[model samples]
Target: MIRVVLPAHLRVLAQVDGEVRLDVEEPTIGAVLDALEARCPVLRGTIRDRRTGRRRAFVRFYACAEDLSHEPADTALPGPVAAGAEPFLVIGAMAGG
Candidate 1:
């Protein structure tokens, strides 16, 4: 099972507590996201753009201490993440004036 830790807001939106566990057949971020959306339909457009299917500007992806928000969607996740050893983190970026 792949583990995903969503930001608080997204957790609330998905009506889930703590980290979510998923069975992902593919190791790509896109595949994980597709499974996430399939499991939580309400989160369809919160993490990525509905039309472009791109990561949102304010949302960041991380795993194994690496920033993957800008990586290609088809890129395979880190070995730890793919092996369910590390949790994929979705953080809501903060802004300041």
Candidate 2:
């Protein structure tokens, strides 16, 4: 099982609390997001673009204390994340003047 920690807004949108657990066959970030979308259709376009399937600008991805927001979707996640030891964190970046 792969663990995913969604930001507060997304958790409210998906109507879920705390972390979400999912079973992903491939250990790629895209696969994990795909699984997340499949399980929570309400979050379809919140984390990623619906047409382009790209991650949102304000959304950041982290795993094993490493930033993966700029990494390719096909890139393999960290071993701890793939092994379900560490949770994949999706953070909503805050910006203000």
Q: What value does the lDDT take at residue 45 in candidate 1?
A: 94
Which digits, one per residue and each the tens of the lDDT, describe model 1 over residues 42-95?
A: 999999999999999999999999999999899899999999999999999999
Clashing pairs in 1: none
TM-score result, candidate 2: 0.97
Every candidate's CA RMSD: 0.6, 0.6
TM-score of candidate 1 against the unseen true structure: 0.97
Reference-based TM-score of each model: 0.97, 0.97
Q: Residues 1-97, candidate 2, lDDT per residue (tens digit)?
A: 8999998888999999999999999999999999999999999999999999999999999999999999999989999999989999999999999
lDDT of 2 at 54: 95
Question: What are the lDDT scores of the predictions, listed in order?
Answer: 0.94, 0.94
